[model samples]
Structure formats: C-alpha cells, structure tokens
Target: MTATPTPSRPVWRTALLGSVAFVALLWVLEVVDQTTGSALDAEVFANGITPRDTDGLVGILLAPLLHGGFGHLAGNTVPLLVLGFLLLLSGVPRALAVTAVVWLTAGAGVWLVGAPGVHLGASVLVFGWLAFLLVRGVFARNLGQVALGLVLLVVYGGVLWGVLPGDPGVSWEGHLFGALGGIGAAAVLARPR
Candidate 1:
C-alpha cells in the first residue's frame, strides 16, 4: 500500500510560497511607487486611515501593502518575511485570517484614535506579525511555538519599542493597534483544549 504524504509537507510548501508571494507583492508595489517619483505617495497617503474620515475607510485594506518610501519598505521586508513565514506555518487560511484581523483592527484603531494625518506603511503588518509571534505560543500552549517565540524575542524584541510613541512622522498608533490585533487574533484562534 502507498503511504499518504504527511500533511506537514503540504503545510510547509504553502507557508513558504504564500510568504514569498506576499513579500513579492510588497516589493512590486514599492517599485511602482518609487518609479512614479512618489506620486503614488500622495494618493496612498491621502487615502490612508484619517481619523474620523469616512471616505478613507478603504485604507484599512490598502495600507498594509503601501509604504511611504523604498527605505520604509526595505526596513519592513525581513520581519515581514520571517514572522509571516512563521505565522503561515500554522496554515494559510488561519494566517490570512489573522492578517485580516490585524489589518482591520490596526486601521480602525488608527481611524478612531490616531492623530490627524496621513499614515501609511507595511509596518502595521510587521507589528502584527511580531506581536502574534510573541504571544501565539502562549495561547496555543505548544512547546515548539514557545521556543520559537523565545528565539524571536531575542532577535526582534527591539522592534517592540515601536509600539510606544516616539519619532516624529512615525505611526505609533498603527504599531500599538497592530500588536493589540495580534493578541486578539491569537486569543480567538487558539487551539481548542
């Protein structure tokens, strides 16, 4: 009798491919944004979640894929790849759902309480993945996850400071809310006992 392929084989393949594709999309968008002399910036930033602006609601969907500059995009690429890969290791469906929750939660929170201005970047997702990685193991009670979280904490813990207000023109609101969203996603999606 032929043995069935282990489910983990497919899960890993999907995680790798999806993570690459998502990061590739971020690069492509940034290339276009750069090529246009940042004309795309005005359009994207203008549409970005503006507190109390009903018309800017769509920023919740677009903001995660948009960045203000190549420098901004460059900074987010590695964390997005690493944490994103780890998140998707759980399975694409769950990962995507978590991303959607984080995206909307961060955007909405920014809209509700963020300072008045245009906020834009992939940092929201970066922060989301960071927080998710930091807490998912606890929520799921998986030793491997716990170990992975510890490793990530060592490597990326510094970024967590972004959650606090600092640096003019930086969107601490996005970081704070994205982290909160990650916590919420972890709680909601935890493995049932």
Candidate 2:
C-alpha cells in the first residue's frame, strides 16, 4: 500500500509559528543581554545607529534586534506577535518583503536624522507593521482587508501618535520612518499583479 502524505499546515498556523519563533529569538537575545549585565547592550549600542556617524551604519541592521531592557522588549512583544502574524498570513515571502522595506526605511531615517544617541529596539517594526496593516487594505481595495484594517485601527490606533517626537529617550524618528516604509510597501505590494 502506498503511504499517504501528511498535509501541510494552514497558512495561519505557519504564520503563527514563524511569529512565535521570531519573538523567541528576541527574548533569547534579551536574556543574553541581561545575563551579561547589559554588556551586549553596550556592544550593540557601540555599533548602533548614531545619526550621521559612518561608524554606526551597522546599527541599521542590528537595531531592531536589540532592546534597551526587558521593559522595552516587553512593550514590543505583543505588537510584534499580532502584527507579524497578520503580515505573515499573506505569505512568508511577501511578509519578508514588507519587513525589509520597513527595516531599511526606519534604520536609514534614524541614521540620517535621529537624535544624538544610540537607538535600538523592535518598536520600529511594530510601528511599521501597524501602518502596513492599517493601510494595505485601502490600497488593495479589498473589503475584507478594509474591515480588518478598521478593526486594527480601533485596537492599535492610539499608538500612531508615536510617530511624533515626545519623550526625550524615544526614537520617534524610527517610528515615523517605519510607518512610511509600511505605507510604501503597501502601495507597491497591494498593486494589481
């Protein structure tokens, strides 16, 4: 008798698993940073984005993966899981493309005009994914997506103000540019193809 092949996981399940794994990685990195008495923080910031500083260019790649502390990481955890899973639900490749756009935009913007400090956190991606989810539907002209966007707007809209400069320590530049990247991604990816 021929063996029956197992069915592949549903897209939602796959997206969920991927989101969880990514969050787990962030947690692990945070643990390492904490255990080392924030030595990793120093190292990461040493190389982290310093506006207009050429030596800090590498931080554009490293910033999203580094957080100030558990408090900082925790603030981003839920948003990352929710937004990331939603983004990935479309497909890993598409999600990756969106993420890449947001990552580069946020990082480059911060590197160009951010305050004079070492900035690092996943909040940039959080803001990016939030914007992408909120606007992609409008661009795609999909009612279902529009409805979903409405729901997310109700739930996450308050955070949108983060794009503005507020706290002295906050990286609002990252948040603002990340949202821009999300909008740009939605414009490009949601086009009829």
Candidate 3:
C-alpha cells in the first residue's frame, strides 16, 4: 500500500505551532511543580544562577524554563506569547538564533552581577524580545519594521521599568541584560542596505 504524502506547512503556521508548543511545555512544567508540592522548584532553585557560585552557572541554560510558581509564570505568559510569535513570524531559524543570543546574554549577565538568590523564569527572554522588537527596525533601516517597533513601544513601554532594581525578590538584572542582549542580537543580525 502506498502512503499518503504530508502537505508542506506554512511558515506562519509553523511559527504558531512552535509558540503554542513552547507555552504548553511551560504550563506542563508548572503543573508538575505544583502537583509535586514544588519539589521541582527545589531542583530549579538549586540549579538557578547564584552569582559567584561556580556550580550554579549551569543554571544559566536552565533558568528560563523554571518559574517560582504558577503565579510567576502567569505574569510572563502574555508577553512571551506576543513577543515569541512576532519573532517567529520573521522566520523560525532566525528567531531561534535570536532567542539563543538573548537567553545566554540574560543568563550570563544575571550570573555575573545578579543579587544573591535563585533567578528563574522566562521573563528574561520576554524582556529580551521586547528590546529586540523595539530596536531591530532602526538597525535594519526598514520603515515597516520601524513602524512596528514604535507600535510595540507604545504598547509595552511600561515594562521597561523592570530593568530597575526595585523589588527585593525580582531579578531586575535579568531584565536589563536581556534587553542588552536583544539590542546586541539586532545589531548582529540586521540586514545591510
């Protein structure tokens, strides 16, 4: 018997599916943590980037995936969805590369200079995407992208306050560094005229 051929997927659809899958993964991890009485959180905290702690450096790679609780994750959900979807719409491979740059920059920045504590959450990535979306157009010299950036700025500008060291428990460093990483990514990835 001959097998039916699978249809090619559209780029937008693929990006949408990837974003949905990522959010689903985050929810699943949160559910597991909640169900296990936060046992998973312990692992997260243990692995979380602790400034000056050599061993905790590994958490740099894992921190974005671990959240303090569902409430924490909830705060990050919309931003992640919006920013991630926009990034992926540009192209999945490029988006992924941009994410990796932001991830490493945010994580390393936190590890190097963050306050003493376990820094965990996708907020880091969210902030990075925000920065990227806000500045990428200027570097690329694209009027459309510039317009998109302005719109994003008007909508999400308030969150920029996150970079300030205000909350005792919040990782403002991550926000600041994630933003820097985003700018960096845009600069590195911008199309030459």
Candidate 4:
C-alpha cells in the first residue's frame, strides 16, 4: 500500500492569525517606543537589569512585535507574509513550534552574545524562517521547490548579514541566535520519521 501523504493545516487561519497578530504587534511597538521611549534598542534588554536591579526580561521577547519606525515595519511585512504562508504550507502546528523556538532561542542568544547596548527587532524571525525553509527544502529533496527557495534566498539572504554585530545599534546577536533557533527547528521538526 502506498503511504498516504500528511494533510496540512488551513493556511487561511494561519494567515489571518499572522495578519492580526503582527499588525497589532507593530502598533503596540509604535506606542511603547513613543511613550516609554524606544525599547527597540538591545541595550535595554542586554543590561544586568535583573529582576532585582531592573526588569526588562519581557522586552527581549516582545521587541519583535514592535518596530523602530515605519521603514522597519514595512521592511518586515513581506517577509512575515512569506513566513506565515510557508508555515501554513509546511504544517501550522509545526510551523508555530518552529517560530516559537526561533523566538525564544534568538532572544536568549541575543542576550548572551549581542553587544552591550543595542535594540532588538524581527531580524531573528526573518533569519530563522530563512534557515528553516532552506533546511526544509534541502531535506525534502524537492528540486523544483528547492530551486525556488534558492532564488528567494538569493534575494533575501543578504539581510542576514545585518544581524551580525558591527552595524552600529543593530542587534546581530538576535540574528545569529534566531538563526540558530530556526536551524534547530529544522533539525528536530524537519527530521524524517
């Protein structure tokens, strides 16, 4: 008997969720940055603001949902669309799981490796998704799809460099860590049974 292919989750739902959540997140980020001052700077979270000294643990995770400005948010919009679509295509639960890992992993990594002072952004999410898709395409051995993935990579992969330190206030650590998180996702979730 032929092995039945697994069914995928509804992309519509995932898209809707991505749309609503990220949009709200952007708006919230705008408000917080303006009112409380731009917490996007990685330094806010990177410092030793321990619960006793300071409390910004929340910022590391929440920063992605916020943007520094319209240009920043606009830059991420397309990537988010692609990632949301890919997750729906890959498997909603699995995609969500991967994203979560990337989020947590990237945040922690940034905290550990990021410069003493910098701001956070969605770069990690973008990095992780890029890594996840690249890994998935290779593992799947789907030539046509992988070819398309390569093209996409060529266009977007350049941004991954921005994640690295030395670019002023940009949080390279988040990018590196987030990329690792994405890679880990592919390693575990993308594994063939």
Quick one: best TM-score, which candidate? 2
Per-residue CA lDDT of candidate 3, range 1-193, in tens? 9999999888788888888889889989889888988766676456567877997788898888888888999999988988888899889888998999999999999999999888889999999999998999989998888999999999999999999999888999999999999999999986655
Candidate 2 minimal-lDDT segment of 10 residues: 39-48
Q: Can you rank all candidates by lDDT, best first? A: 2, 3, 1, 4
Local distance difference test, candidate 3: 0.88
- TM-score for each predicted model, relative to the true structure: 0.90, 0.95, 0.93, 0.75
In model 3, where is the ten-residue run with the lowest total lDDT?
Answer: 39-48
Colliding residue pairs in candidate 4: 40-119, 41-118, 41-119, 42-118, 42-119, 43-118, 163-172
Q: Please provide, for model 1 over 81-114, each residue's C-alpha lDDT reduced to its tens digit, 9 standing for 90 to 100.
A: 8888889988878898999989999999998899
Q: How well does candidate 2 score on lDDT at residue 141?
A: 88
lDDT of each residue in 80-124, candidate 4, tens digit only: 777656655666688779889998888766665555654456767
RMSD to truth, every model = 2.9, 1.4, 2.1, 6.2
Any runs in candidate 4 off by more than 4 Å, and if so which? 1-13, 16-21, 31-54
Query: How do these models rank on TM-score, best leading?
Result: 2, 3, 1, 4
Clashing pairs in 2: none
Better of 3 and 4 by lDDT: 3
The TM-score obtained by model 4 is 0.75
Taken over the whole model, the C-alpha lDDT of each candidate is 0.85, 0.91, 0.88, 0.68
